[model samples]
Target: MGSRDLHQGATMTAMSGATIHQVAKAAGVSPSTVSNFLNGRPGRMLPETRARVEEAIRHLGYRPNRAARQLRTGRVQVVGLVVPSVANPFWGAFALHLEGAALAAGYHVLLCNSARDPERERAYIDELWADGIRGVVLCSSLPSLDHVLPLVEQGLNLVAFDRTAQAGDPSRMVNISVDNVIGAQLATRHLLELGHRRIAFVSGALRSVNRRERFRGFRDALENAGLSPDDAIVWSGAADEPYGDLDVAGLGRRAAADLMRGDDPPTAIVAINDMCALGVSAGVRDAGLRVGQDVSVVGFDDIVLADLAAPPLTTVRQPMADMAAAAFTHLRECVESDEPATGRSLLMRPELVVRGSTGPVPPPR
Candidate 1:
């Protein structure tokens, strides 16, 4: 081969392992300029310079090393989502909407299930932080966020969902939730208007912040109606369980059966969520009672199933898609901001959707 041929061969070998430096050299630009273009922050670069970089990348088959970039910047184009459980379909729907919002903003999500375990949630946040993730949307709704406070102090932008802000939360943490107290009051008031004075509140455990607020709302509505809150039967048989996200339906079914068998059975039931309400309906059937007639049922979190259940369900509708979008937008602002800002709480109003499952209390049997 001639000398020219040997030179061309050497150039080909070098191009095979092209780096950012080589791309900058070929494009006649500085490495920092090339970096800015690659990172989607091409600020005030002349059009021709960008074209040259694009051409160089195409010619050399250059691929940016994301891991190396993350290592240097201490952040990535990905956020973490730690949820309590995926077994419940409401959570599944929320995840879908949150992922949609993240994709639109040029970011991806890493989802983890903590089953409402504080230790597990803390561990997941720690792992994400170690992996260079600087933002997270936590949906555990644990009463106290003390477990994850240390990580938040270290610059983790956290958005707490399905839970209201608490006194102990980090100053820079965002909290987003439907007003649980009002939502529950709406549910109970609907039953009260239906003349369901013998009402019962059913749930797995009152351990989480949201659950506690919901229970409080149930009591408030009863007391405001000139009825003794103490007269309401609260069945929280699974309160001692670690986390009852998966078996909530089962818990509701059992509560219904036991409550219905009592000497003074409740005329109406208020469930924690739609899944639990569906189970309660089934239990009412098992007791030879017809839902919406012999016994009334009301639920929270008007998940899709609520509309499709037999006789449908009366539920409190949470604006899930809107809430998810807001979570992403707030978390992104925190992640991209140059300086940390004081966090804010967003309390969305809930709508009570009346359906076939709730009706006036049955005539004296």
Candidate 2:
């Protein structure tokens, strides 16, 4: 094209909003060279030259079309994240951080929620592979790693968090997680220190490694303190304790009439998560028991509800932000590494935050 034509074309493209071509020109480099630089692939280019392209793309606010970018560079610049049950606030926030990190690095993200279903997890895994993507960050694991093993064999980069054991290879995957066992132990130890005996453990699906670890810590505290954890004291739930409370509320004037009359009542309860603990709190109120006065509670995952609950929850605080950042860092390494390096798992220590929800155990009746 002539100078005038080149000028007109540039104007038209600019008017439409800057894309890869504009992004490249603004950086004074060939479009292919810019694509290589952005994708973190080696090209016969200098560091200073690459920096110019990167700076220009940032200054111009350029976003490349996903399709064209993929065609020019083998990398789709898409990080596929498979999370378990976005309904959980923990998973939801983690997904947001993963996407944000990818975006800041001038890439896009494809998020898929497995909803704790193995079948759906397999399906999403198959589809992301078929779609020809850069890599994946698998948040949770299923009973079978058949789908995942193949991805590794096919030379697809993969990293996992929270469920690294199920990934089948520590050297091939990175993990970002809380020290679940320690976190739980910390929460449980606090209650033991407060002299709570006959404490009940409320847990979610036992399949969750994190929850299981939390339960283990709770059990250890009871054992370490010379208290036998009555197997019956543990409640594995799907309906949640709150639903039992809802049923109680439905009883209207009769609510609290049958409080703990069914069997021996504990002075405090330990919950696997904030949601389950919230349910336990509801049950406590529905039964006319004064939480933190008549009974105390401890929860894990110090979610927002941990602080907002009527009796603010004393719980374990997983370093969600730091974990998120670590997950992103691990993922970027997987994305940018020339070839797979031996994978590493990193666990952040959890902190126990004592709030109004827990207190010294009430005197024996």
Candidate 3:
């Protein structure tokens, strides 16, 4: 084409919203080179070549067609995050942080609430696949990965954030988790140090990997302290299918009530989560006992509300934001690469946050 014809073609393309072809033509490069630049894989391009492509993109105000790119690449720049329930404060905070991190990486997050239902989790996965989303951060609370394994086999770039042990093949997907066992050990040892021999453990479902690990840690701590592990009262049951507040705090209250009614009640209680600890506090008051004074309580997952409770709860702190960022970076690498990225697992350290809800054991009557 002549100079005037080339100018006119560029103008027309600009008026119609510039695309890869127009940008490539203006830069005197192939479409693949433009694609490479757009995807942040500007490999082996001379500085002059890269500058030309960048200048063309800026001059034409070109916005790469994500849909067209998806058609060619078989995946979109969107990732789905599946959580058990956003209603839980811990998960709520987690989702917010993950969304912010994903946005910073030039990707969008599609939030899916599985409500701890197997069928719902499977349905969300199917919908995400149908919508061309190949990356997922699954925070499932279930004991089995039967519903998620098929998609992994089909080449989904999945990261199991919390309940990772349940994911069948750790070698096939990225896993990020907190050291729940250590967190639980810290809480239990804190109670033990306060001279409380009779400690109660209030937990949700033992099927959840995190909860199970916490329970094991509690037992290990008791054993290490030369106390009979069996003497540590444990109240755990099958969690509700459609998990809710009742499944958490309300169940905690019920367990606390049962523990209090016993002839030999525990002097201190360690709960599965902050929500449960809060409920146990309420249950203690209802049973004519002061929470921190009469019966000390400790919780896991120092959620935002942990500090706002009547007596701020002593709990375990997980670096949720850092974990989210690491998981997203790893999943994005898998999504954007030709081959799936090498699988890796990250275990974040958990800290103990001592607060007003726990104190020295009370004097015997």
Model 1 Cα RMSD, Å? 4.3
**lDDT (C-alpha) at residue 198 in model 2:** 67
Candidate 2 regions exceeding 4 Å error are 1-64, 141-144, 164-167, 238-261
lDDT of 2 by residue, 173-243 (tens): 66567888888789888988988776777654566566677778888888888877763266655443322
Q: Write candidate 1's Cα lDDT for 277-309 as tens digits.
A: 999999999999999999999999999999999
Per-candidate TM equals: 0.91, 0.78, 0.83
Residue-by-residue lDDT tens digits, candidate 3, 88-124:
8888999889889889988999998886677888999
Model 1 weakest 10-residue run by lDDT: 1-10
Where does the lowest 10-residue lDDT sum fall in candidate 3?
1-10
Can you list the residue pairs that collide in candidate 2?
A: none
Stretches > 4 Å off in candidate 1: 1-18, 25-30, 39-46, 59-62
lDDT of each: 0.89, 0.70, 0.84
Reference-based TM-score, model 2: 0.78
Model 3 TM: 0.83
Better of 1 and 2 by lDDT: 1
